[model samples]
Target: MGEDLTYLSFRVIDKKGRAHILEITLDTNYPKCPPSISADVPHIFNLDWSGNSKLKDAVVQFEHHVDKLQDFWSTLDDIDRSLWVVDPKDPHFAMSYRQINIGNDCYITLSVNASDPRSLPQCRFLGSDANVNLLRRKWKINCKRWVKDRSFSENLTSILDIELPQPPEVRKDDRQTECGVCYAQYLPIDDELGSKSGSATDYTCENNNCSRAFHSVCLRDWLRSITTTRRSFDVLFGNCPYCSNPVAVKIINKK
Candidate 1:
């Protein structure tokens, strides 16, 4: 293979919060290993983390396309045994493999991109160029993939969705007269049907007129019934449900 192979290295975090440095060797001896076929493989190296954590819970999975070698081992009893017999030079004999280790979890996947390059009836060794090139390029790409753990300071803006120009303060409006039944505020009702109760509450709706109030459980039940039945209320007590003005019923969520 000589200089036909290329090598790539990657730093991976396993499930145990341990870091692993992996090296992959690719054989770039084939014509199919050009940039066109390998572009998609490089972008798959991105890392996504759900929250503050250094370890990955699962092993990496690999996927690839098989161009040929459709029936190279149709008559073989054992697939692994047949793999050893297939000629490497076959253009239809494309190969892609990936291995990942996450703590104690490990996985290995393999596939073919092509089969026979010669297009001959009998199996023929097309040459070492294609096989070596394909392997080298694949290994080179995979070994370069890495995932890094980010700190809160580095990712705070993204998590909060806004930059802090000043320190956050406790707003006085956050507190409201919570209902005794449900211990929630008497706010606008999102649902219109089902259980409803006449109660006094201080919670206001987005619409200024609708000043209706209700126990939390009553409002919750009413909303649930309306949603389940897919119905709407026209007017509540002859006033706007939200602004309490002389208007029609509008759905609002009772806090």
Candidate 2:
């Protein structure tokens, strides 16, 4: 059991020797009802339950599920550690999409398969039209070189023909530039496809020493809340949260 008695969590290691967490939300009725499951998996496993099912049964099922995803997790871990991933700012175990910066104002998003991890993944390129078109051509030309035996990074290098930027081994700032107010790049409006999306940051402080960026919507709300914010015709003025230096943002119109 976890912090609360009804919330139980267990660790399951995949064949590759990586640990994953599985949490079960028990129904109040216990054995008579099935428990809900949450795990660090690409897809949720269907629970096998009956009146005879015990609390331990859920953990056992999740452990078996982890075994099937060994290769999937292994490939993703390599990609994450190998590249300068720009989106999903903080990578989590459950997400399968990776948006990596590939230089020249462009990013390439890869959607890897959970089952056949070594296969060429579905890809989409983001950035200026010129860069996207050029990247697509490179992908088409070099995709046939992808080998299952090679690591994801190796295959990507062959396809792009460019040196990829690895995660900064040493950096002055390790913090993600999430909105200082809402503190997230994307927010889910609902569990289904109706979810709303958010941009990371549009406005940055002019002070070079404190170049903190913030989502305009989040900054507007925060500025409005503070009595010190100055209101102009169509702009709000305030000091940067980190440096106390002056900053301003235009009022976004809903119409």
Candidate 3:
């Protein structure tokens, strides 16, 4: 059994088609003998991720099945090791677990390391082939299940099925000549321009309660100045001079 169980190897492929290899060496007299079976018998040979992207974009999952050694494995006697890249500059890294065991029939571990060139974490396992195989099969099944359910169309259809609220209608009135900003009557202009002339002030921000009135030239200058100052042309700037409340600015053509 010693020579037969000397080494074990496994490969991992991430969603992005990156491959990683893991190798472990087994001691026939593990945990029982001292010198031959070193305390660190189950060592993590290699734990790494592929792809040009860093490990942060990767995830690893493991499951262990130790049926005959359930009691020993379940007692948390097994060592847990981790592999990580310590240097901020390194691209790949690995870690190992000494011993670990959970109460479940099998131990399933899932890990996701955030992308940071400063730190990259990886996964590990210390168990028999049977245990590794069990875990690998389950991982494969879960991956297939996930791929089948991933879709945006299903979500969009659900949203489209829901009823939407109606929007309010807009009305226009021309009977009154009002300042575009304050919506106040254009200050009565001198009759020199005639009855159709209305107010010489061409436009105002139509907020009904504002008082600011401007000749088209004056308003244009104000707008240009505001634009140069990087101020928004929105109502949040304050109402026109004629109105106390917020007002909308509008441009009217005198022609």
Which candidate has the top score in TM-score? 2
Ranking by lDDT: 2, 3, 1
Q: Write down the RMSD of candidate 1 (Cα, Å).
A: 28.4
lDDT tens string, model 1, 148-184? 2332222322322323232123243442355422555
Query: Candidates' TM-scores?
Result: 0.14, 0.61, 0.19
Q: List RMSD in Å for every model shown.
A: 28.4, 15.7, 28.9
For each predicted model, how many residue pairs clash, with residues at least 3 apart or on different chains?
A: 34, 0, 33
Cα distance off (Å), candidate 1, residue 189:
83
Error of 2 at 163 (Å): 3.4
Candidate 2: list runs displaced more than 4 Å.
Answer: 1-5, 13-19, 172-255
Model 2 residue pairs with clashes: none
TM-score of 1: 0.14
Query: How would you order the candidates by TM-score, starting with the best?
Result: 2, 3, 1
> Which ranges of candidate 1 are over 4 A from the true structure?
1-46, 58-79, 83-255
Runs in model 3 with CA error above 4 Å? 1-163, 174-177, 180-183, 187-197, 200-221, 228-255
